[model samples]
Target: MKLQNSYLADFLSLLFPQLCPACGNDLVAHEKIICTDCLYNLPQTNFHLHADNIVARQFWGKINLETAYALYYFTKGGKVQNLMHHFKYNGMQQIGNLLGNIAGSQLNKNEKFAGVDYIIPVPLHKSRLKERGYNQSACFAHGLAEKLPAVVEENNLVRTKATQTQTHRSRFARFENMQEVFVVNNPERLKDKHVLLVDDIVTTGSTLEACAIPLLNIPGLKLSIATIAYAE
Candidate 1:
C-alpha cells in the first residue's frame, strides 16, 4: 500500500510539476527552492573565515560585536537580487530558508558560531508584520536554527516606531532614523547570553547597528551577526 501511495504521489507531481524558484526550471527530485546549477553558481562572500573582513568592519567603532558575517554578495540586477525579490515579493519564504540553511551549514564548519544561546532576528513593526504575513529575516533565522540546531526566540525585539524605508535614506540618516525604532523585548532574559542576531541582508549596516545598540547595552550580553547577503 505504501508503494502504491508513492507511485500515486509521483503521478500527481508529474501532473503538476514543480519549478525552481531561482531559475524557474523544473524541480529535481530532491530540490525545493533552487536548482543545482544556480546553487553552485550563486556568489558567496565567505566572510566568516577572516575577522577583519569589510563586512565586519561596518560595525567598527559602533557596537563592538563578537563576530559578523554575510553569506552572499548582493549585486543590483543580479541573481542574488533576483533571489531576494522572490524571497520578499514572491512569498518565497522557503528561499530565505534555503539561503539561511546553506549559510548555516557553512557556519557550522566554523567554531565561532557554535555557542549561540538564542537567535534574534531584526524585528519588523507589528503593523508591517500584520501586512506582510511574515518577517523575512525571522524566516532566515528559523532556517539557521535548524541548521545550527539552536533554539530561536521571536518578538524578543520590537520596533518601537515605524520609520522611512532605509533604501532612500543616507547612511547617517538610516542610523538616526532607526535609533529609536527598536527596543529589546526583555532585557533580563537576555543578560549573560551569547546571542546570534540575524537579518536578511546588510546594506549600509546602519539598520543592523541601530538594532544592535539597545541589545548590546544589556549587561554581559554578547552580539554576533549573520545575514543572507552583504550589499557591497
Candidate 2:
C-alpha cells in the first residue's frame, strides 16, 4: 500500500511539476527549491578558509569584525539573485533553510566559523514582519543552527522602526539611513559571546553594519558575519 502511494505521488508530481525557483526548470523528484545544476553551478566564494577575503576587506576600518564570509557571489539576474528574489519576495521561505544548510556544511569545514556561541539574524521591523509573515534571515538562522553549535536568537536584536528604502542610495547615505535603527533587546545573552550575524544578501553591507553596532557594545562580544550572497 505504501509503495502504491509513493508511485501515485510521483505520477501526480509529473503532471503538476514543481519548477526550481532559481532556474525555472522542472525540479526532479529528489530536488527541492533549487535544482542540482543550479546548486552546483552557484558562484561560491571560498572565503571561509581565508581570513582576509573580499568580504573581510570590505569592513577594513569601518567595523571591528572578527571575520566575514559570503557563501556565493551574487550577480544581477543570476541564479543566486533569482534564488534570493524567490526567498525574499516570492514567499519561498524554505530556500533560506536549504541555503543555510549548505552554508553551515561549508563553514563546518573551516576553523574560523567554529566556536560561535550565538547565531543572530538581522531583524525586520514589526510592520515588515507582520506584512511578510516571517523574517527570512531568521529562517536562515534556524537552518544554520541545525548544523552549527550556536543557538538561534531571533529576538535578541530588532529594528526600532521602518527605514526608507535603500535600493538607490549612496553607500554613505545607506549607512546613515540604517543608523540607530537596530537595538539589542537582550544584552545579557550577547555579552562575552562570539556571534555569527546573518542576513540574506549583502551589497555594501550597510545593513549588516547597523545590526553589528549594537552587538558590538556587548562586553566581550566578538562579531562574525555570514550572508547567503555577496553582491559584487
Candidate 3:
C-alpha cells in the first residue's frame, strides 16, 4: 500500500506540478512552497546573532527592546520581495509560516530569544483584516510558536484606527499617522511577561514604534521583536 501510494502521488504531481513561489521552479517531492535552491539562496540577515544589528538599532531611543531580528533582508525586485508579495498579497500565507519556522529555528540557537513567554503579532484593523481575510503576522507567529516555547497571543493588542498606507510617507509623518492607532485590550495578560512582538516587515520602523508604545507601557513587560524581512 505504501508503494502504491507513492506511485499515485508521483503521478498526480506530474499532472499538476507545484511551483515554488520564489523561483517559479517545479517543487520536488521533498519540497513545499519554496524550492530548496530558493530557500538556500534567501538573503538571511542573521541579526539574532548580533546585538547591534540594524533592525535593533532602529528602535534605539525611540523604544526599548530586549532584541530585534529579521529573517531576511528585502531589496526591491529581489527574491525576498517576490516571496513577500506572494506571502502578503497572493494568499500564500503558508510562506509566512515556513519563514517563521525557519526564523524560529535560528533564534532558538540564540540565548537572547530564550524564555519568550508570549508571541504577539502586530494586529491589523478590522477593515484591513476583513479585506485580507487573515493577518500575515499572526500566521508567522503561530509558526514560530511551534518551534519556540511560547504561546501565540491574539486580540490582546489590537488596532483601534485604520490609517492610510505608509507608502511614500516621511518617517515623522508615518509616526504621526500611527499615533493612537493601537490599544491593549487586556494589559494584565501581558504585564510582567516577556512578549515577542512580530510583524511581516520593517522599513522606517514607525508602525512598529507606534505598536510598541502601548505594549511598553504595560508594567514589567519586556518586549522583543521579530519579523520576516527588513527593508532599508
Candidate 4:
C-alpha cells in the first residue's frame, strides 16, 4: 500500500508539478513551498543576533522595542520578493508557515527573544481581512509559536480603521495615515507580558510604529518586533 501510494503521488506530481515560488524550480519530495537551494540562498538578515540592527534602529526614538528582526532582506525583483508575491497575493499561505518556522528556529537560539509570552500579528481591519481571507502575519506567528514558548494571540491588537495603501507614501505621511488606526481590545491580557509583534514586511516602519504605540502603553509590557522580510 505504501509503495502504491508513493507511485500514485509521483504520477500526480508529473502532471501537476509543485514549483518553488522563489526559483520556479520543481520542489523535491521533502521540500515544501520553496526549494532547498532557494531557501539556503535567501538573503537572511540575521538581525536577531544583533541589538542595533536596521529594523530595530528604525524604532529607536519613535517607539520602544526590546529587539527587532526579520527573516530575509527584500530587494526589488528578487527571489524573496517573488516568494512574497506568491505568499500575499497567490493564496500560498503555507509559505508564511515555512518562513516563520525557519525564523523561529533562529530566534529560539537568541537570548533577546527568550521568554516571549505572547506572539501577536499586526491585525488587519475586518474589510481587508474579509478580502484577503487570512492575515498573512498570523500564519507566520502560528508557525513561530510552534518552535517557541509563546502563545499566538490573535484579535487582541486590532486594526480599528482601514487606511489607504502605504505603497508610495512618504515616511511621515505613512505614519500620519496609520495614526489612531489600531487599538488593544484586551489590554489586561498583554499587561506585564513580553509581547512579540509580527508583520509580513517592514518598509517605512510606520505601520509597525503605530501598532507598537498602543501595545507599549500596556502596563509593564515589554515589546519586540519580528517580520518575514525587511525592505529598504
Q: Give the TM-score of candidate 4.
A: 0.98
lDDT of 4 by residue, 195-219 (tens): 9999999999999999999998999
Identify the candidate with maximal TM-score.
4
Ranking by lDDT: 4, 3, 2, 1
Candidate 1 clash pair list: none
Q: Model-by-model lDDT, in order?
A: 0.86, 0.90, 0.93, 0.93
The deviation in Å at residue 123 for candidate 4 is: 0.4
Consecutive 10-residue window with the lowest summed lDDT within model 1: 21-30
- Give each prediction's root-mean-square deviation over alpha carbons: 2.0, 1.1, 1.1, 0.9
Candidate 2 to truth, TM: 0.97
What is candidate 1's TM-score against the reference? 0.92
Error at 137, model 4, angstroms: 0.4
Q: Please, what are the lDDT tens digits per residue for candidate 2 over residues 70-124?
A: 9899998888888888889889999999988999998877776878999999999
lDDT (tens digit, per residue) of candidate 3 on 63-120? 9999999999999998889998999899999998998899999988877787799999
Score candidate 3 by TM-score against the native: 0.96
